[model samples]
Target: MLETDRLILRRFHKDDWQDLYEYLSDEAVVRYEPYGAFTEEECKQAAISRANQEFFWAICLKERGGEVDPIAQAAGKLIGNIYFQQQNPPDFMCWSLGYVLNPRYQGQGYATESCQAIMEHGFTKMHVRRIAAMCNPENTPSWRLLERLGLRREGHFIKHKFFKRDAKGNPLWTDTYLYAMLAEEWPVK
Candidate 1:
């Protein structure tokens, strides 16, 4: 598990389905994502599935002070998740980073904090040589978050891919903005 000032980046647990459903069920939260809003059952399976995956980290708010109940403190709300997975051949030492956050937690620095921690872990502990991220050109918040994490805007692909289909079964192509950072470029913390 990784801890930031007010966040905890930990692995998902099957029982976290409720909190998982909280944000995943919101259409706005999944707007730019490949998948649409999730159903409760899908979230239940997702939490279980994510629990078995080593790359996904559940982002939780660190409960503060001594006024809260012990159980509540132990089980923080799962605001979202961070996906940091190693790319092809293990020899590549490259990884891809992605994230999804609840709109309620938007405008705060939790996303940046969790991502920074993951990047640090990847570089220092995982020995990752490079990390890359991609997002729709229209997702300004996503690309901006990438920049805040110090990743350089590397490329802009035109009509790169499509995640969803239209009512007529036509592909909805979208442009992508790629960002990357090398281990050597990471700031010493």
Candidate 2:
């Protein structure tokens, strides 16, 4: 598990299914995600896939600080998730950073804290040079979060991308705003 001042990051597990579905299936929690809500089967696959992977850790809270305490929360249960999809020779010249916090946990500055930790991890541990986040224009919260994390708005692709939809189904194309921060531009403590 990855620990922050008030949070922890770890992978998903079978026990997380009920809470996972509780938040993830809630449109408010995943409204901006690329895909619609997941089925039980999808959630199962997700847990298994994430558990088997080296990356993919759920964000939990230390709350009171203890060893072996699943003290962190998931998708805003306590904190939220911060993840990276790395590239050997990054095609886009960056790793994609994604996070989702339950609406009940919004505006608490958890995303900012979690993101800051992961950003440092990506640059220092992963030796990444650039990291970026993509969000729909309508997702003001996410956009604001990226900005709060110090990523500059780099691109605004209009209707070039789609989400929660398929191209074959009239493709409700959506505008995607790309925000990025380079290792050199990262703030120094």
Candidate 3:
């Protein structure tokens, strides 16, 4: 588990399925995501699948009062998630980052905090040499967050992503921007 001042990044649990569904089921939240919105069953499966992964983390809000307690940890509300998947051969030491957050929790800087923690972990503990992330070009907030995290915008793929179907059942193709950072470029704080 990883802790920030106001958040805890821990592995997903079966009990987190409902909380994940709350956002995963929202079309607005998942519109830019490749998988789009998910059904309750899919959310449950996702929770279970992610729980088995080493790099996925459920972003939870730390309990108040600045005191560590088991009950508080158990009761901590899940607000988002962050993950990094190895993207290349073991010798390459590369990873891809992804994240999602509850819409109600937007504009709160939680995404940035959670991403920073995960990126640091990936670079230092996981021995990752490079990390990359991508988002729809129109997802201003998302790309902006990537920029704020010091990831350099490397490429913009035009009409390369077939995200989902529109109301007319036509494939929805969107442009994507890729951001990346090298371990050597990341400041060690």
Candidate 4:
């Protein structure tokens, strides 16, 4: 488990399926993300698949804490979710970070909190030398978030293919960006 001052970043679980579905099905949340809204079954399958992954986290506020702990914990409300997609070759010490927060919870700083926790986990615990995220240029929020995380803009590619609007629809091309941070380039703690 990964802990931050106000949150705990841990693996996704079966219990998270319902909440995951709620958030994952939101168009705003998945707008910049590769996948669009998910169906209920899709959410369940994803939760099951994620439960077995080593680097994914179900972001939440500390269930137990000092007086500062919020009266409620951070599960069902799902301000957002974050995952680290491993590089194709397991030998490579790198990952791609991805996240989506509920639109209601946007601008509350939850995204940054979860990301900082994950970054610490990736570099210090997961031994990742390079951590990266891809953003859609049109998605200003994600674009700016990557910069806030100290990840440098590696490149901006035009006409990148993302998921289709629906299962049987033709794919659409959008401008995408790749941002990355290296162990040596991390900001001083």
Candidate with best lDDT: 1
Query: Global CA lDDT of candidate 1, please?
Result: 0.90
Estimate, for each residue in 1-189, the C-alpha lDDT of model 3 and write its tens digit: 888878989988987899999999999998788777889999999999999998788999886344654686646888888878998587999999989999988898999998999888888898999999999989899899999899999999999879688899998888889999999988633
Evaluated at residue 34, the lDDT of candidate 3 is 77
TM-scores of all predicted structures:
0.94, 0.83, 0.91, 0.84
Each model's number of backbone clashes? 0, 10, 0, 0
Model 1, range 66-163, lDDT digits (tens) per residue?
A: 23435654377788899999999989999999999988888988899999999999999989999999999899999999999999999999999999
Candidate 4 wrong stretches, greater than 4 Å: 63-77, 165-169
TM for candidate 4 is: 0.84
| 126 Cα displacement, candidate 1 (Å) | 0.6
What tens-digit string does per-residue lDDT give for candidate 4 at 56-145? Answer: 778765643334445544443444578787897878888999887767667868788889878876788878889989888988988788
lDDT of 2 by residue, 1-189 (tens): 556776777777765665556567777677778777877777777767767776565766565333445432443343455667875576545788999875656687878888888888888787788998899989898899999899999999998776655556766788999998999987743
lDDT of each: 0.90, 0.73, 0.87, 0.77
Evaluated with TM-score, which candidate comes out highest?
Answer: 1
Task: Write the number of the candidate with greater TM-score, choosing between 3 and 4.
Answer: 3
